[model samples]
Target: MPDENTDSLRPPPPTGWRRRIARAPLLLFRAGLGPLLGRRLLLLHHTGRVSGQDRRVVLEVVAYEPDSPAWTVASGFGAGADWYRNLGADPKTVLQFGNRHHAVTARFLSAEDGAAIMEEYGARRPRTARRLCAFMGLPSDGSASALRRAGRAIPFVRLESDPPRRLESDPPRPFV
Candidate 1:
């Protein structure tokens, strides 16, 4: 939309106060208050590719399927983001949404699939979509084509979990 280089549009990883603010949600997830944030966000437990140490980050959910218990998330900061790259190195990981933790594996989606998902997300949440596009330095006009373009440029990951097993303490409800 901006005619600028796509790479230039991508934001660098946050630092200083911005990094601290961006990571604040992780504290909530760690404190078992993730449910308070609802299904719109999820906590990802990933491993550092080089360090081989566990890492955690909270990401926004772009699409979710209750039946398959899958959550689709976009790397708004582009593929260079540490979490995204780590997943590329090793897709097997864990995802925590709300109060439920799932043993999930990451599946990278095709550009076409990402386009479709972003379009659907824009339709469902126009304001949020526009904001996300703007944040990613994409067009924030909220048009289907613009959102689809943004989707194509960004990387999307689908976290698929094992078949749901009901636990005694867990309520009979779908995991978002």
Candidate 2:
């Protein structure tokens, strides 16, 4: 049996049609609808950490730095999410944002950096920030401290592009 803390942290996985519903966006992206979503969202082409099978997931874009070709994304389901874990195991991945696609490496940011990013994101998109925080089981009180705390709790990954892809035979670990 799982402990109370584990149960609390583990959000129920979507099932049946709901699972398909979640993947509909990925299908749209595959069908060349990426331009429609623009920079607000992106398609993460990743490899499964355990199975080593290819996987795709659509995630919201919290921040995009064009010059560095870096994108910051939050895991609304927290760090325990399968995709997040996959990236941790192997940061080599592909990112498709709008019409641009790049070979990217995932870098986990420090809590302090996450806090600042979250604050700036909230200022730009208040409602979305609140909703995301609530969904992630973080406090959504709309205060700076609360936002910072939530940012610290939730995992933020920076996808930096133009990196050389590491061979599969390489050990499972972050490039950075």
Candidate 3:
């Protein structure tokens, strides 16, 4: 793994209008514009760990299980990200991919798993992997060791939805 003293992979989170601009896709997803991104991105709905308020963030999907309602995402901002922390506090959340929304349980992947996933993702999307690494301030060489280092520095989460078990007292939301 790279030394901890190394600069963060990506720039610090944006502020003011920049933050709002970054979040525009969240609004678009809620407004039903999700399909435009297809399986590349997912809208994660989670609760604020401190304020106890609902929050959502759009994350790039690292891998999507075709036969299952499971998706993997990476925190390009590393483990200290608010969304990542919130998910740690409460693993149960919602993930919206395109028009399909599913309630999922979050699981933090092990470093080895993250490394493997990153390698596969880099292999499948070499350009995206290089760009992502560059944005994160990591070397964009796309080498196995370089990818493993990037994976170790960033945090990866897998979201898996449970089999439906609707409650009689609760209403069900339509899922496209």
Candidate 4:
């Protein structure tokens, strides 16, 4: 188990070649090859808080709900991560999963909710959850309580798709 006093063992964001490798997914996303990554990952398009310039990053989908059309992701690098902070500044953004894009609004999940989600994820994907916990510098005992504890520490964001708008040129459908 990780020391309770130490919130995270995660290192600072990557630099140099590590940064390049970390950003490789963005290239694939830009090349319209995001489908190759399937639904497990998504390309987030957000605006820089300071620069007002657009920024993009590929993040893993921690949990997905088809009915809500929502995708939850965690900031492995914690709250100080650029992307996480950027979303706080402006929750409205675009999310690209596979080849489809949707206008989404970020909803920050409470620590309790995050903990539950983490426990469920661990149950569903034990190995991946363990690896993720290790990567985040959290406990990887493959136990529900441990996973929940880790989850409570990590920040989670749920991206919900905005309802699609009808075009002015499109005819309205008649009620069945």
Candidate 5:
């Protein structure tokens, strides 16, 4: 029911510099290589509300869960980011990784989960921790607790991938 009966709340796509960046991300990345250079690119396919069709977008792959219920992906620019907004509006989406397309449902991460991951991130990538924190717009409040608090504010999407699908020209299933 996530996408149902939300007629009055509909609006146009995001615009301005963000729109420009979305349109030509390669150029933006070229212009700012340090923070913007990304290796993994994922194509997300979602249902368009007004257009009543499928919408495909290229997103930079961020985080993946180890043995958790969902895999998390952070919006580099924070909550107001377009892809985050779209997934929030509609949970159903498909992530294209190379030639494989994975059907998925996305949800915002719980406060506890976000905090734990933030700690892990700081520990694992200490050299870039401060800059990364600032990039998420977290103020330097001095307390380590402040970092955890900021983690809760930074939006994170957890994607739950669907079961495997079979192709027409595939071999039989492997034995258990």
Candidate 6:
């Protein structure tokens, strides 16, 4: 794959018929249901590598590593993928999950480390990681062991959930 700059993996799919078809579902989803369900969708926002502007993507969180509580993102097309490239350049990003926003820092990890974490997720959860890997066409290996050295195979993030939003004032205090 091309280096970070010249990489063809980021942005949209490679220009062609297959590319159009490949991304049709995402387009349809965003057009039809994105607005109604945006708050419920788990979204990630990453800056454009070239434009230096923000870009948002709806993603399904596959697994959260225990002990460390690191989030794992399977880079289906590997480091050459657009999201991966963006994170490589800038690890800082944001995530919208469960009607909440989080400031996050992302880091890539080795295949072994990713696989181990994947294993843990698959073992504990119901095919969240396995399904995601299969959907992304990533190798589903070692997906029950704890991640040993997560450093670029997968993009994992550390997140701080944004504080709750308050609107109306609290009700009158009850007698004690």
Candidate 3 lDDT, tens digit per residue, 16-73? 9999988888888988999998788899999999899999899989998977779999
The residue-by-residue lDDT of candidate 5 on 113-162, one tens digit each, is: 77666666656655455665665456534345765665665566778887
Q: What TM-score would candidate 3 get against the native?
A: 0.86
User: Which of the predicted structures, 5 or 6, would earn the higher TM-score when compared with the native?
Assistant: 5
Identify the candidate with maximal TM-score.
4
The 10-residue segment of model 1 with minimum total lDDT is 1-10
Q: Global CA lDDT of candidate 6, please?
A: 0.54
Q: Please report, in order, the local distance difference test score of every candidate based on alpha carbons.
A: 0.88, 0.83, 0.85, 0.88, 0.60, 0.54
lDDT of 2 by residue, 1-176 (tens): 11245226635667999989977888879999889887888999889987989998999999999998899998776677788889989998898898678999999988788889998888898888898777656667888888887777767899998756689899989789
Q: Assess the local accuracy of residue 115 in candidate 6 as a C-alpha lDDT between 0 and 100.
A: 51
lDDT per residue as tens, model 6, 6-35: 223323344788767655545645455444
lDDT of 4 by residue, 117-144 (tens): 9999899999999998887778769999
- For model 5, the stretches where C-alpha displacement exceeds 4 angstroms are 1-41, 66-70, 127-129, 140-144, 165-176
When 2 and 6 are scored with TM-score, the better candidate is: 2
RMSD to native for every prediction?
5.8, 7.0, 4.5, 3.0, 7.2, 7.1
What is the Cα-based lDDT of residue 80 in candidate 2? 71
TM-scores of the models, in the order given? 0.87, 0.84, 0.86, 0.90, 0.60, 0.54
lDDT of 1 by residue, 68-175 (tens): 989999888787789998999999899899988899989999988988999999999999999988888787598999989888887899999976568999877878
Report the alpha-carbon TM-score of model 2 versus the true structure: 0.84
Q: Poorest 10 consecutive residues of model 2 by lDDT? A: 1-10
